[model samples]
Target: MSSRDPSLSPTLRLRARGALANETGRFETERREAFDDGWDLPEEERLLRTEVRIERPRSALTYNRSPDLPFDRSVNPYRGCEHGCIYCFARPSHAYLNLSPGLDFETRLIARPGIAAVLERELRARSYRAAPIALGTNTDPYQPIEATHRLMREILEVLAAFRHPVAITTKGTLIERDLDLLAPMAAEGLLRVGLSVTTLDPNLSRRLEPRAPSPARRLQTIRRLAEAGVPVRAMIAPVIPGLTDSELDRLLAATAGAGAVAASWIVLRLPREVAPLLRAWAEEHYPDRAAKMLARIREIHGGRDYDPAFGKRMRGEGIWADLIARRFRLAAARHGLDRAQPPLRSDLFRPPPRPGDQLSLL
Candidate 1:
């Protein structure tokens, strides 16, 4: 039996033509001659190898003009996620760097070294306006490398120094390291956080989001953040229709019980190459229900893999969509989790002191 561990980040380079098929996860080996003309590679080189490498990016902040998103500007401290969720929409982004979106997306990573300084300069610019700068909107900021790189911590330092209001979304337990910063900012209403917990089942969560913090740990994060006076919202994102959708109400109740003050959810989305990649993964893991899951996703997407319409992109249209929405509302209402989280205050923002600036003696 093939090992089904999801937490391990394995590198898989393409070995041979026709070795990869949609229906199976196992690879079969065959012998080949060195003189095969159509074979671009020699038989000796057919044995594939994977090497881990790190990429450094020049600049850090990414600006977005999409009307659908709440924040106009955001920053990503890392590129290519270590948490290999098969349904991740961001996977296709790897194609821009001339890499396959499958295994490459999980193994290949980019780290920004000077992001914190760049952010400080941008935030302190003369014309820079103060609005909440979101973190972890693309790739998770607190992924495994965060412990050593400390880019997220530096970014938070800049935000804290300038009194800039900021929001964060993450699933890594590493975020707990920054509570000292977040707790105080949250005290002044300058920060808020959302924890995206997909499912409570450890087995399912293991396969769904390989490198993310365990479900129990996420619940603990909610409890700790709430205890620290930081407004915490539990986000049940990318709800797979026939798979994890069943855990909706239970997830909400559990998170609320753990002290999450607000709740939100997004239906499963199969945009771009994610559609085919997810289908391949489903066939490998749950062959029996793969077809049914795809069908349910299409039913909500109007017979298509995805619909990128502004309002309907996040939440699809149809009876299933309506049902999920209603279920979320009822569950949140029952849990007394409907209180509106106050917006982070922007009026408190003050530019940081210039270089070599002295502490005020007054």
Candidate 2:
């Protein structure tokens, strides 16, 4: 892979944030930089030109006891998303690897090259119990890099072998590549997918999520999955208050038209490092409405950029949130998208046979 060159435009200047820190985790402003051009940079420095690094986790199942989450166990095949969605809540996770959550969160990626084998071993362990394993709950598993890594596919093969149920959420059109695995799994009620479409405007989408699939492409992905008999739910996530909230009904209508069976939405969240990154993004892209957007978000968050309190974190707490919620509620109801689809079957899961064990003769 060719190395990405730093921008050389005379008008270009770096925007620094507290999220930038070296491997030592020491906060130094010099380590941070960003281009305020607000337009696409040259291909050599587009930020998506990142080389993936591989890391192995001792275990793959990240057990979540949070009552707010729907699944108990989830797996992330990679860290730091290539999609470069400026509002990603997963950005802060980069700090754990001694990396910056700013540019590094997009450019510096870590993949678990052998995660599928590890997952298979864990699933075959006697103590293992299967529930619906959620993919893309944190960093997107189907991010652009998955084209070569194919970790999600390997993991899916393991899930299919053990009759394990799974739920996936992603914004990548790349998920379409796995339809063969997902279609059969969906037939058995063992799989369901949630495609998150934050906005329908291609221009807004490009600024908000530089490398993710175009909104229209995502709509096509949903249609394809639906046609393949895969259960699909449209996720209108992080509904940016003063920005995308106005499009709530239209986005829902369009997605529903494209074949989404059910729908859900979450208010914008700016937790940890994400708050500063989003503030920077707002300053860069939506300068005119940036103040209004941040203010509205703060209003919903009780004068904070974000509130991580269980249900409040997902939806937020004030009139703005309520209004958005109401609009989404009415829209979903009117469109008949308010209905909850059935959950994937957990009872179908059977622990994989352990090594050195006799094959079942039943």
Q: Tell me each candidate's TM-score.
A: 0.85, 0.88
In Å, residue 40's CA in model 1 sits off its true spot by: 16
Per-structure clash totals for the candidates: 0, 0
Off by over 4 Å in 2: 1-48, 351-357
Candidate 1: regions farther than 4 A off: 1-59, 356-362
User: What is residue 145's positional error in candidate 1, in angstroms?
Assistant: 1.3
True lDDT of residue 338, candidate 2: 94
- lDDT per residue (tens digit) for residues 178-297 in model 2: 998999999999999999999999988887888888999999999999999998899999899888999999989988888888999988889887887787677766678989889999
lDDT of each: 0.78, 0.83
Q: Each candidate: RMSD to true structure?
A: 6.3, 5.8
Worst 10 residues of 1 by lDDT: 16-25
